[model samples]
Target chain A: MATQRILDFLATRRPDGPCLVLDLDVVRDNYNAFEKALPNSKIYYAVKANPAPEILRLLAQLGSCFDTASVAEVEMAMNAGATPHRISYGNTIKKERDIARAYELGIRLFAVDCVEEVEKIARVAPGAQVFCRVLTDGEGAEWPLSRKFGCVPAMAVDVLRHAKALGLDAYGVSFHVGSQQTDLVAWDRALADAKAVFSALAQEGITLRMVNMGGGFPTRYLKDVPTAQAYGQAIFDALSKHFGNCIPETIIEPGRGMVGNAGVIKSEVVLISRKADNDNVRWVYLDIGKFGGLAETMDEAIRYPIVTPRDGDAAEPCVLAGPTCDSADVLYEKAPYPLPLSLTIGDEVLIEGTGAYTTTYSAVAFNGFEPLRSYVI
Target chain B: MATQRILDFLATRRPDGPCLVLDLDVVRDNYNAFEKALPNSKIYYAVKANPAPEILRLLAQLGSCFDTASVAEVEMAMNAGATPHRISYGNTIKKERDIARAYELGIRLFAVDCVEEVEKIARVAPGAQVFCRVLTDGEGAEWPLSRKFGCVPAMAVDVLRHAKALGLDAYGVSFHVGSQQTDLVAWDRALADAKAVFSALAQEGITLRMVNMGGGFPTRYLKDVPTAQAYGQAIFDALSKHFGNCIPETIIEPGRGMVGNAGVIKSEVVLISRKADNDNVRWVYLDIGKFGGLAETMDEAIRYPIVTPRDGDAAEPCVLAGPTCDSADVLYEKAPYPLPLSLTIGDEVLIEGTGAYTTTYSAVAFNGFEPLRSYVI
Candidate 1:
């Protein structure tokens, strides 16, 4: 749906070279859709997904809370008119000063998966509501998170108990199935693990009041994905099954799922060439790449839907890449897409469903290529 | 060594968080070393390596040529007092306007791999000197380049002939053994491939005056690498064997080799933790990661030597990661290094020999974190 909007926007704006078109209306629609889908759950837009002020302002107007990964994101949300109470410091890793600054900025709720993080928060922001994130399989997500965060159920229980000992609020438990989650069962699995941590915490005389189902919602890219409705039903069914009668107040932090399908990237084909005797494979270089904007193509784990302006059939296969000098800046090569053989330099290509992660993850000065320009309609 | 210099600089600057320190003296020494090694070869410091004005200025004053890949880089070199004659637009893929802009800026030397690029150059800047880059195996390199560039011998010959037909000067042939090349034989193989294209061009009665060996010079990171003297001798021997009686004027576009050893990254260990019951693998998260500045950790392909301030022996194996919320930001997992187990939050670690690709390849903002800031000492 965003493709048509982006096409219309491009027709009017005539923006040039690797531009990201973010529709605030579409963002609002996604927010409203999430609100309706998870009626009982609090929605915090993960600001790291797309920290654009325009998008944040629209979300703020809709009374959406924010999951801030850093002090900058907290500021971004606040500058967009979000109060500190409506923001949660979501990232587990933080410098002591960042924690102090976030506390000074009025953010009370924080998520930590390690003892050091909890200790830092306890010292800097006393009695702050803390959520201990439990480890997950991180399976079935297009962008599987690293084992960089989250702790085992036992570790989570210990960390939460430590938080209580350090005079911080032993508030809740959180988990991420991973980014761009596909398997609905992933939530069921992660929730079961979370419930064990909750039970273990209760056994240690700590009563948890909240649960954050960290974002992992998927978008339709290259393939038809489950709708937000399905995700909502799956989450509700899993929560009901896991928590039984003791269902606590719930929070859902949806980053890519909320805004992913709301934006489109308008990039131009820079060149198309066959290296040496590369008979079967043709390389189609775009003005955008890993550094440019399409970094979610991390190992082709998240494939975006392509829409070219050309009328001819896109029957010929070609390896796709970005314009940066880095070889890894390539978008796709092994699983080549059926691009039009007639496509050449200056032809426009629209990569759809890149609303999230594109603008935020760009490597600004990689190859002196300009950071992807964005317009919010 | 730059270690003592960095320590001295850090003693005074006291820069906190992750910082890239580029040393101008080290750059000058590197330039002199390369000059001494490859006496006959023209040195074009690949500007994409580290486009810092100080580094550029030092190289410019040393009478070095620049291998520019973008309009901005072309301008950077010129702003650093490098004339267009001393800058070769090395990137094969370029927009027509960029070609025109480069030409207008007085850059005559260009690199092209295909017919279309040649056509653009011929139309935009007629009779411009064009170098045809041939395909290489891209083997034995930490950062394996994309097949997005260069063509085979026959294809290169045809493209050069087409350039001649279009009134563009098909001036030379070029090849990249790949970046951070370890196996010295890779250059020999690539040079051999370049020879075929060169011989074919001569059969068409076209003489190539310049042969550009695109940058792939290695920097000592985690292991001992060959010296600039050794590389110079190897290149000379290879050129003598390949071209026999008539060797073309030589050019070496070194990015990492020239600057990689001259810069050091001072990053703080953000958090160090292990998953529940995971007594085996300790995780040491740094304020820097793939996005922050250590992007060469492409599947642990390029390992930078770590120098920590800990007095104890570094015998503990740990997974390294960036401070970003992305799961994929894990730097090293399987190939765990013996980082000191006592390493904790705020512990400063120096990643040495990271001058070239580190700053240039850093992502602008991945998790609301600032881009990698560099200080030239």
Candidate 2:
């Protein structure tokens, strides 16, 4: 939902060109909600979600740690007042040079999914705390992360052992259920794998001290999602079931859930017409599309809530597309979006729940359009 | 294949990060090939494909016209020495203000797929020459452009008539067979539609001039594609079959064909590992992935030819991926690319057939990596 402040900002400022306007008040509220939901676990806010300086600064001031995906992200977090100890270089696939750069930047914690990555970190960031990511089926995720990321549980155990042998701290295990995960128990299956790695390492006299539960938290799109408290309770139960009374020190990396609802994209209808006079579906083209910032709609996965002035009017399914010349620029086609029939060219529309995974994914002048402009209010 | 100049430049410079090295000689050769192939057609270099200033300047010097998608591209073409008369505002989707801006910049050629778009152009850029785009099935394209772009052939006649009614020049008809199109006969069906629109407008007493045969020209990827001469012959035959002696002034928009084979991206292997001990495939993580400039690899559609130092050695299929936190960063998994077994982290790899649709599609800084760097030799 567009907050009253954001709505007022759009009404008054009316900045031209498709831009994302994010309200810091909403981000503050979301941070508080997460802190309240999982009081024990540390909140490592995923910087890749929306690395707007304002959001990072505010989170830093609020005593939140950062989960960085690159050396640049580490610098962004540090520049925003985060200490080196509060940042973790979290991406599993990293170049040895990038690992060295992160170490030079004073980042001590790293993520690994294989012995190759572990060796890179060991060679560069010696004595760093490392976490091995285990593969998850991603069953309930809207975007199923295929086996592109994490290694299997047995491989993770070997990776952690290799890290320990290389004189690095095999401090934890991690797994991402997947992005936009809605199922409350999705973490249970992943937690079982984490526990398996933990038990296997313990047998070899390697005591893992923490479980870095990776981000899979959902954001409200077109449908209602469970609250952060619901997820916290489910995760806590899973941790207790797996580790018994020895629940390890845990951390939650929330990217989308932390910032996905704090921003709204203000766009205008570029064109609206049917393919033919008798064509059932109307074609609605927006100044923004897949390349502009709505890349989450690639396979029509993230159905963003669109607000039009004529919401009360009758609606029909429209084939929505971006302003670019590329055919892949279509946002919603497999499942057409039902937009108000009264919508016409030049009408302003607010796309909500777009605060995350948008600005970062925007191409740099894909069709001579600039990267999606972002304004943090 | 990496052009000799590009290979020499990479070997000498050894750019630190993943970067594209384009040989101007290749582009010049391609321009001449296109000119020789379609002698009668005015060549409009699609600006959306690898709009490096050096390439644009060379094309402008060679007397090639431009197909611009937005105001920025129009300005770029003009800045590169092209006059407004030589540049076509080719994208069908446009903001009314953009049309006015283009007109103010002295552009007159425009593309329209519907009456709504025509009305916008008519209202803003009065007396502009507009071409109505008809739909193509995109049957033979590796990247099939869906119904997101053009309207049906029957409706294109109405669109052009509406343009005439609005006092705009009903210039001609346009259609795209699709991007990375390999079929020689693909243009035949689309040309048939274009002919029907032209005939329909001719009967209505509105003389349509120029057939803007939009780009579908393929670039060599993993397999061989027909030559420009072959496509030219096929298109000429189709034109004669459809329009007979009245084959009006023609224009060809060649994006990928002009630049795709002119450049190569130099990237390093970040890691090489398997999921489990029994896993059959090796995951080859590269410094570049879908976001870094390989977005055409989405759905394993454009399988770019990759060359490594050990290409002739024993080979096996590897799951290729980029160095990003996003799971979708995986380039090839459904059909993994065969790589040398000797491939390992730190080995240099060259991604060929990347001159077009690469730097433009690169994310500004997704996961904190800068956009793909380009160097024109």
Candidate 3:
């Protein structure tokens, strides 16, 4: 995709203020790359990343399933032509009305993480196919999911037994290592626990048809982070070895890994001020804030690269802030300040790797700022 | 305000989800305290904190000035019955159209931080009353506003001189020490710098009419922080001593100090899971995320207390997490686990100190979650 095309498109359409640009070419390439790494498994595009109806429609055209966590997400997928059987309502905290709505809408593949949730689903959607979420022992993982919603392996087996007693179909097992997970060994450990749970359920005359390796595939942000292909292959090999024949189907929900770097939040440099404590270090304020694309990185103590429209060699370090009055409106700190380009007040700065949570999860209509505008390359 | 009455009102009126319950009684008390402490200064309620129309109406009733940072904020204040002359368009990086709109709407007071901004405002709001924002030399302040929008003290005088030449009224000097500023000595140093700027301007035969001191009054969140009264009194004393009889009319803009603790974000507990590494620890998940009530505390590395509906003996520490898929959704780590007394599946938890930025700034409609419902007491 031509960068100038997007720039020109935005300049023509959303010339009033800042806008987020999504690159469909990069998104399709990311989806194909992940599919290539896990050739045998089904790729459930996590619509929580960028739930633009057009993006979801494109993924559906590419033969991708969806992992929806809410009724709204489910409806979004359905609107994009995703069949109920092809979607998984994977969130554990199932609202009673939402569960009833999903069941009425024919969404049967529900993910449950606790005994109480299993009972709730059994009461609401007795015919639903449940995926018992198992807790992984992520002792050294970067982002551990077991701390919040999943049940223990033994408890998961009990949940499966409860589902059997309630005459509900318990057909699969799932585990999320965590979001932005950096360690491949954590996948290996989670797979081992999943296989153990599968065998234990089999001993009780319950056969599992699918094993869902929940999405935590890391997206490339910093140069040192591992690529998506590297992480996908590691999980694919582990699933192949552990649950080779027992599980005929596998589903992977890759949200950020597939779309995080495919979009950029383009904003204008509104103000620049030199720091009084350090004259060399200046602060650049953009026309956006924590309410905009930087919402995901808020308080995460992480930094994203800020690139100016023009390139130069005289780079310095500067703190990047947003236009909001709140003190927490900073976008990046101590970022490598771009060199003096042939740009002035209205020049744009493209903040990359914001595709995942930038638009679908964080943009608000506060201060009358315009919502994100998208384009297909 | 009666907490029980407010709770009952919200239970009936608030939408079925995570929402904010704003109490105007507490806000009135806060406003009066700040007004009493700075008896001589004109108080401007920063609308960026909680810009709900009801909040603005209450502040207007209290005879406070309106400090608007955007055109929408200015419109909100005006819609709440504030005269344009009582409103100050105080943002440093403003669009040309917004400036033009403010000028057309008859807003007189404006803040200018740089030479470019002065030129822009001159072209847009030539009849506006302008104040050159000076960067203070006081380091170690809690929230430094100079890092993003203000000019150095020496350069500020030059900008003021230019503002006078551009056929605009260079009214006086203004400086923001920072948000949630706790250091009294920093205010002393900033006041001293402002006095020096005042003397230099006076020598040039510029009789200033207003010395606007930007807001940084600390709100009560953690116990160790000083009260708003202490900070307000210190500022008043510093300004009176430095300028003596030649003091210009004092102006202050308080955002969080007036409304930070005046509201509570009430959410229901959906799911709970114990940590794998520590058997004694558990994690309680709420429907809100970092995108909701916890937006202000982002990256601050601070924890807020969570109060259960039915108080009980504190159990072991449990981490509180949000419904977002990100691992950074953890709201409080090692929070004293309030015993789940009478707290079954759908019990409510009150998260406080969310009145400031919770709704106006961070409540994104993610996962189909609508913005919060507001009720004034």
Query: What would the TM-scores of all predictions be?
Result: 0.98, 0.99, 0.89
Report the lDDT tens digits of candidate 2 across residue range B40-145.
Answer: 9999999999899999999999999999999999999999999999999999899999999999999999999998899899999999999988888999899999
TM-score, chain A, candidate 2: 0.99
lDDT of 1 by residue, B315-347 (tens): 688888889888888888878978886777888
Question: Which ranges in model 1 have alpha carbons more than 4 Å from their true place?
Answer: A3-5, A311-314, B311-314
Instruction: Provide interface RMSD per model, one decimal.
Output: 1.5, 0.9, 3.4
Candidate number with the higher DockQ (1 or 2): 2
- Chain B TM, per prediction: 0.97, 0.99, 0.90
lDDT of 3 by residue, A1-377 (tens): 22565666676777556767777777898889988888888999888778888789889889899998788889999999999988989887666777899888889989887667778888899868888887766554444554566778877888878887887898878988877778888888888888888889889899878888888886656545677678767877787788775545888998888887777777888776653433776667788766766675454434555577665745566677777665566766644445463446667777766677777555454554555555554
DockQ of 3: 0.37
Docking class of 2: high
Model 1: docking quality category: medium
lDDT string, candidate 2, A1-377, tens digits: 89999888888998999999999998899899999989989999999999999999999999999999999999999999999999999999888888998899889999999998988899999999999988999999998798988889998889999999999999999989999999988899999999999999999999999998888898999889999999989999999999999999999999999999999999999999888889999989999998888888877888999999899899999999999999999988888899999998899999999999999999988999999999899
Per-residue lDDT value at B306 in model 1: 88
DockQ of each: 0.73, 0.87, 0.37
Segments of candidate 2 deviating more than 4 angstroms: none
